[model samples]
Target: MTLRAGVLGLGVMGRHHSRVLNELEGVEFKGVYDPSDAVPSHIEGKPVVRDLDTFLDMGFDYCVVAAPTIYHLEIGTMLASRGIHALIEKPVASTSEAANELRDLFTAAGLVGGVGHIERYNPALQSARQRIQDGLLGDIYQVTTRRQGPFPGRIADVGVIKDLATHDIDLTAWVTQQEYVSINARTTFRSGREHEDMVLAIGTLSKGTIVSHTVNWLTPFKERTTIITGEHGSLVADTLTADLTYFENGVRHHQWDDISQFRGVSEGDVTRFALDKKEPLRAEHEAFRDAVLSGDTSAIVTLAQGAAVVATAEKFVADGLEHRLTTP
Candidate 1:
């Protein structure tokens, strides 16, 4: 069965989504919508609809809301009201309150609402998550993430925490199967904008794992990396290159007295796992398509999870310390 999909907001991310949808096997790229004249008359050989209602009237199985963060709540609510499934961009909405409203709208409509937390589809991250769950990284002690890149001039409403760090916030909790128990964060406004350009955050998870994230828009170059440390060793994943490397701990053999003086810590061996790489955006869209067809939301990022991430991101923006109990 072929599902027809529409792209909303023909911005940088929106164009990518439209291109991928056209390339996907079981999905048809119907068209796109943008208020401004930024989009060409034809995108990837398809017409660009300037009228949003006309685009919706084209009969879409789902729509990808890649519009600015400020418009997420409005577009998402429109989609939900039309009984159309939607795959909204990361951060879900501009703020926590709006995110909750979208979540409620989707839930009440019984639609397959998904967020574009595309990192969930990264092959390297997926492999790392599997290894951790399989006890390769026994008893995770700490997880550190670094996501830095130049300032995207397209963004005017949100700061680094909401734009970049939210990915790590969602991925960290999802990979560890834990809930954030407490969070502490600080922000720096190097750009003199109303929003922050850099953020440093530390959070504790339900399972006693410590997570730290450094995200900013001031970097000269881009980097997407994650490091997971455990008693046995550490696992490093570079999402940019789709590589997962493990550094094992060396065996310790010494006299009984030596145990007190020397800690048995040495880099044993370096191993990088081979992965069949695919574009994370394509995988994310495919997952959303499948969820709409299968009636199973098990694999996609649920609305509630997206809302939780937004709530956490808001906490980071507030530069406050918070302690919350895990809910069953």
Candidate 2:
């Protein structure tokens, strides 16, 4: 049976998802929903339902909710209550309490719930994680991520930490397999919005690994990079370029007792891996569809995990608030 799927909110990102869902196998793009002034010309010309209740009434087996942040809890809770599978956008909600409520709602309904953590499906990230897990990055010491770009819109309601840094937060946790025990964050706002335009955060894991993240929407160019420093070497991953560079240079035992016998560090081999094919979004859509069909949630990041990412981000935001001495 063809899996009937509908996408909610066909804005910029939702439109991209609309295109990929159609191309993916075993997915029948039943319709799309967006209250915007315009709608896409494709998707078998299904109705762009203007009513939430009526839209949910239609025979959509599952949903891909790319709606705005505020509407996430409302629409997601509604669909999840109806036992419909959902893949909501990141930051799950504005707060951890709300995020967990949605997770519990889905769990209670026995429905599959996932998030659009598109970065998790990146081939480069996947490869890097595999290497790290394979002991390539023996005893990781620190991980740093940088995501900067020219300001994007609709981010006034949310800060750079939630809008941009959340990706790295989730990525760092996944790659390093650690939970943030503590976080210290600072923010700067130039857009005059309640949200911060630039944010820097540092998190320490129980494993003694330190992770620092830099997120800014006011940069001159677009950059998506993650650097992981392990005991043996360091890895530089560029999502935009689809490349991973590994550097092996670190301190070693020196025969200094032999009077000026410090051996110079050897600039170890640098290897760059190419992501041959497969768009991450398309892969993510396919994974979601298959997981739904198989009734397994292994491949896709579970709603609970996604909520945890939001939880950490929430902590960062809260830390920022505390730093400014506001009762957030």
Candidate 3:
């Protein structure tokens, strides 16, 4: 059965969602709902709807809520009321309360709802998660992520923690199958924006695994890297290039007296696995589509998970604010 799908935004991510929905298998691209005068009247040869009610009447089995963070709760509530499934973008809502409401609404309505945490679909991360699960990384110790890039002018509603660090929060928990237990963070408003432009967060997970995230909008170049260090070795995943490298812990004893005095483990062989680098966006769409088709949600990030990430981000912001720093 071919399911009908529509998109709710026409911004950068929304445009890409429209294009992918138009080409996705077993899915019929219905159109889009973006009242912005700036958005064109058509996208992917489909009409760009101007009215919310009119767009709802188009009969979509599922809708992609690619609208800004502010509109997620409204759009999701409307979709749930209409008995339509929804795939809301990450950070599920502007606030944890809003996200929980959306989650409860969809759950009560018995509709398929997922959050768009696209990093979970990245091939390198996916491979890393699998390997870690398979005991390749025995006794996971730490997860460190660095996601830095120049600020995108399109974002204005949220700060770096919510905008970028949410990716690390969700991905770290997912890769290790653990939830954050506590977090402390520091933030700076270097860009003169209402929201912070840079953040450094460190937290412990439910399994006692420590994690740290370094995210900012002031970097000169873009970097999307996650390093998972465990008992046996470390797995480095570069999501930017979809590469996964494994550094095995050295088992041989050092010959030099100075080298042998090192307390920590030494590096052994390094192997970069060949991965099928599929477009993460397309993979995400496929996972959501499959979830909508079947009654299974294991493949997609649930709204609850997304809401938890938002809560963690809020904690980071609050912690940063509580411990204000002054320099002489």
TM-score for all predictions? 0.95, 0.93, 0.97
Against the true structure, candidate 2 has what lDDT?
0.83
- Lowest lDDT 10-residue stretch of candidate 3: 258-267
How much lDDT does each candidate structure score? 0.90, 0.83, 0.95
Q: What is the lDDT of residue 121 in candidate 1?
A: 95
**Using alpha carbons, what is the TM-score of model 3?**
0.97
The better-scoring model by lDDT among 2 and 3 is: 3
- As a whole number from 0 to 100, the lDDT of residue 144 in candidate 1 is 99
Error of 3 at 303 (Å): 0.8
- Candidate 1's C-alpha lDDT? 0.90
Give the per-residue lDDT digits (tens) of candidate 3, residues 1-328.
Answer: 9999999999999999999999999999989999999999999999999999999998999999999899999999999999999999887999999999998999999999999999999999999999999999899999999999999999989999999999999999999999999999999988988898999899999999999999999999999999999999999999999999999998878799998887688779999999999999999999999998897999999988889999999999999988867678
Q: Give the higher-TM-score candidate: 2 or 3.
A: 3
Clashing pairs in 2: none
Residue 175 displacement in candidate 2 (angstroms): 0.6
Tens digits of lDDT, candidate 2, 8-127: 987778778878877768887877877665665455456677767777777788999988887889989888778789989887777788889988999889898888888988877888
Full-model lDDT, candidate 3: 0.95
lDDT of model 3, residue 192: 85
**Pairs of colliding residues, candidate 3:** none
